[model samples]
Target: LLAAAERGDYAEYGGTSVTWAEMEAYFAQTTGFRRPLPWEPGEAADQIAGNIAWAEMNLDAAFEAARTTGWLDLDQYHQQRRLLIHQQLLRTAAFEMPAISTEEARAHYEAHLEDYALPFQFWMRHIFLSCYETHRVEEGETPTSIAEAIAGDRAAALEIRAMNHRRLVSGWDVPVDEIDERVGPLPAGFRLLVPGGPDRRAEVRARLAEIRESIHSEADFIAAARQFSEVEVRNRGEEIGPLPQRGEEFLPELEEIGRTLPIGEVSDIVETKHGFQLAMVTRRTGDQHRPFEDVRESIVSALRRERRNELMLDWMRGLLQGRGIAVDDVSSAEFAAADASSERVVARLQGEDPITLGELRANWEGLNAAQRARYAERPEEYLLAHLLFERTDVLDEIAEEESSAWMAPLLHIYDLVTVAEPFISHQIAEAAAQITEEDLLAQYGASPERYRQPARVSYDEIALRADPPSASPEEGVPDPTEMLMDQLAESLGSVNSLGAFRRVLAEYAIDLRAVTASPERSSQFRDVPLEAVPIEVRAHLASAEPNTVIGPFANQRLVRALWLISRTDDYLPPFEEMRSRVSLDVQAQRRSTLNTQWRSEALERERFELVRPDPLPAPSEATEP
Candidate 1:
């Protein structure tokens, strides 16, 4: 039944014919896939047949409606149908494309050897220590004031310990636990590294550094990784290879180290988000071409696709040559200058009538705005391309070949859509035309709250540095925050305007720069939304009036000064101002209703039956043909 649908006249109505050839062509054109052949009977073929059947039925219905609506007699409708058929024929011809041979595939592979070259591979072992450890609170545990303070102190001490450990590992002679004692004490407001306190990451990193210093061979490194590395693969000697130059499994830091690290030599301490790591390249392979046998099938498939594309291009070129559509012969400037209505001859076809400027203009006008804009500068090229496409005779000649059978269904589908689209669009437009100003007004009145705009406020802010003082102050030096606060208190009294405030900050040697290189800690924001205001500063902003300068308000991290710019109260816009929005909403609602009604009616008018193919034989039971 599928073969019958593809090879001969399957359906006809209202003086319109739908053959298997046309259907296949339509299918190929629309889907970019050939319909399944008769010998390859399966679910795919059954689905294609059902789809083509439905399309043929609809095309027949469209033809009937065109006649009933007097659109059949319209020359414009006939011209569109002719153009659609020409496109369908071209698609059908594409199915007759030649296949790529094994020899051709081999030749392509030989010509593009560099394209198949593999990236460098590294066989490596890594020892990693995680920075963070999860801690769960006991069920009955409660935080007391002192306990909370102690916890905070412990966190700060741990951070200092980690830093000291890093310093000690990087050739600093000071002991990690005795940094404050030996280095003349930490400056004011700085936390001291806890003596003998547990900082597992710092301890692990120090150990890893020691291992790097001691390891003289790959065996020793592997032994240390198996003993101390946190990763589960440490049991397998912490081996992670043959890793490509870059892949998901390969850590970016590890890849960077592996790229240059000599084989059998351990890498320096490599810091990563997870923890500190020490990587050693056990073995390495340079870039190499993949053997042809391994990649032969892929090459063949690629060559076949390329060959098909070339054949299609050649077929299109033949059409252009056959029809005297010399696009280059027509001057773009002259075409642009010519009046749209002028009957000037642009190109003369071989036996057919000469293409007129007026005809080209008519076709150009028929295109949508985007298409017109795309061809605006080269209208002659666009006009000639469409003119060449108008030659259905060439398409028919190409489509007649038996090899084009697979594209017939696709061609039929394209034809159905092209024919039905205008009618559907007309119906939808007619449905929408029923919507009136009264309907729009009713929609707006029904959903007035939906149009209410939320109250919004905009302000300018200066964000103070969130970083701790880069270095702790020496003895007799005041803390940086305390000093800045003291300066601000004395200067803020006379600072009324933003300019005055900026001058005070400048006098204090505070410049507008990113704090810790983060945009979130940027020095200033202008016209920032009220909703986006930091929670810490929102209360102050709520009570402040426009044009008022407020703050030097201190949070845990940042001190902010704000200039309240403006605020607007929430309100619904007037109906007159929102009429356009209401109309669009009503149109969308009407379009949905019209589309549902159209589809429902189409379903009622068309009777579609899906024919399921017989199940395929089991591989064991199947016989060779």
Candidate 2:
């Protein structure tokens, strides 16, 4: 400060925070009236001094200009942002429906009883005659005659498969080890049977035909199934229980066979991709209507879901149609090929709003590589949904109609606060130098609680969703949630390094693709709560340091492999470290007094009644100057 430098009171500050003593120096310098401190570097001191000298000459004029223009514009900007969000969230609570009654649910159940029937399931068994062969050279052919053409006859292959079916029907099977030795090793798409798996279809068809010839009764068919048959049903002698009702859930050939097979007779040879089979319908559960009590909950759930979906769909459709929403069909391949950086228009909505390529990428960014690949098959559905919900601003009319009623009072208060800020600061500035340096130091000493720091630490988390048991699973059964947890336990039970941690994740198929999560080098879980994380994992996070790999813990279906990248423990920084911050604290302290004084003056000058409810004061830092 000019007065201080002439009296020599300058000192060191400003690497991290301004302390109590140096806070005084900052006050003298930042008031825009004091000359630069002598402790400031040579050229820096003169440069700052010259700038302060110029500000000192026109400081009052600058404040007046700001009070007239800047704060008014800022108030409008804040109000507009609030209005946009406020209108979109408003609802009168009238649209929400009451819970459905039991009588209503039962009445609806009687009319659509068939819709609630359990899927046409079968209690049936089958005989599978697999075609497993060595593929050896025939007696007529020799290794010396390699140049000569070899047999590629389907009929010959069919004969061999038929002979195997005859052997299975007669209670015989080839040992898996012998088959494995002769066939070298089983190839891809052949995992149904252990050691030796599924066979080629030419043989499968022949085997089915042979089974049709051999199976004369339920006894014979069951006998043949016991001797042979592969896949999951082999354990139950080729019995596929709880038969699928949906065509898509099973092989087309098998579903057709189930539908047409006589109640007590053998099915004709069914040529399915897995193998050939002869089915016998042992029991049928589809003809009888299901009991009302058994389906009561489902019927009620269906009706509620139907009502909700219809309401939402109608609302969405009206919105889209009203806005004249239109889409341009961009093939997934074309969208992929376009410049990823460019804002090239992929589609447009309401004849005017362009949906860009970059926006489309962001739309699909939340899905993992597998999910993205799956969605690529239905590009139109993904794009249209994204456009409607995420990209389009649907609140324009609502904001105009409703924002004033909901937001007017709040906006008025905000306007008052923004407009009054600069004038309050000018009032504080006028009294700032008059307080005297000793009294300022006395005030700093009195407010030690202002320098208190709360305990704040940053942490990291790894979130993983467990894989489903079967790629194509039954609709209502609960899924297995151990996929990632089991893998992480086996793979990372002893992992030590970050490289090993990453390798374990890659091995187990846990990739971080959260929409808002970034894979930072350190401390990524500052906003995440400890309770949301798995209990087993919290110990590792609390104990581990940077680059430490620490989990395979599960919270419901999500399994994780957390890495504690770094931590920042809660402690107050040393006074020198907080000198700059303390300097701002001094300005805020002075401003609070001016604000209180200005409010009193405002009460006398203004005519408006205050309707705001007053609450007891909460302890808080003074507003920054």
Highest lDDT: give the candidate number: 1
State the displacement of the C-alpha of residue 42, model 2, in Å, after optimal TM-score superposition: 58
Give candidate 2's error at residue 408 in angstroms.
12
lDDT of 1 by residue, 281-399 (tens): 87776688899999998998777766775566566656677765543344677767776687888766777777788778777768899988867876654754576565435554554
Stretches > 4 Å off in candidate 2: 1-92, 110-114, 137-224, 230-238, 244-256, 262-276, 287-625
Query: Any runs in candidate 1 off by more than 4 Å, and if so which?
Result: 1-112, 118-287, 290-298, 309-393, 396-412, 461-495, 500-545, 548-562, 601-625
Q: Which digits, one per residue and each the tens of the lDDT, describe model 2 over residues 93-155?
A: 114533677898889888887776666777688766544333333344321221122224322
| True-vs-predicted CA distance for residue 90, candidate 2, Å | 4.7
Query: lDDT for every model?
Result: 0.60, 0.51
Global Cα lDDT for candidate 1: 0.60
Error of 1 at 390 (Å): 9.0
Q: What is the RMSD of candidate 1?
A: 16.4
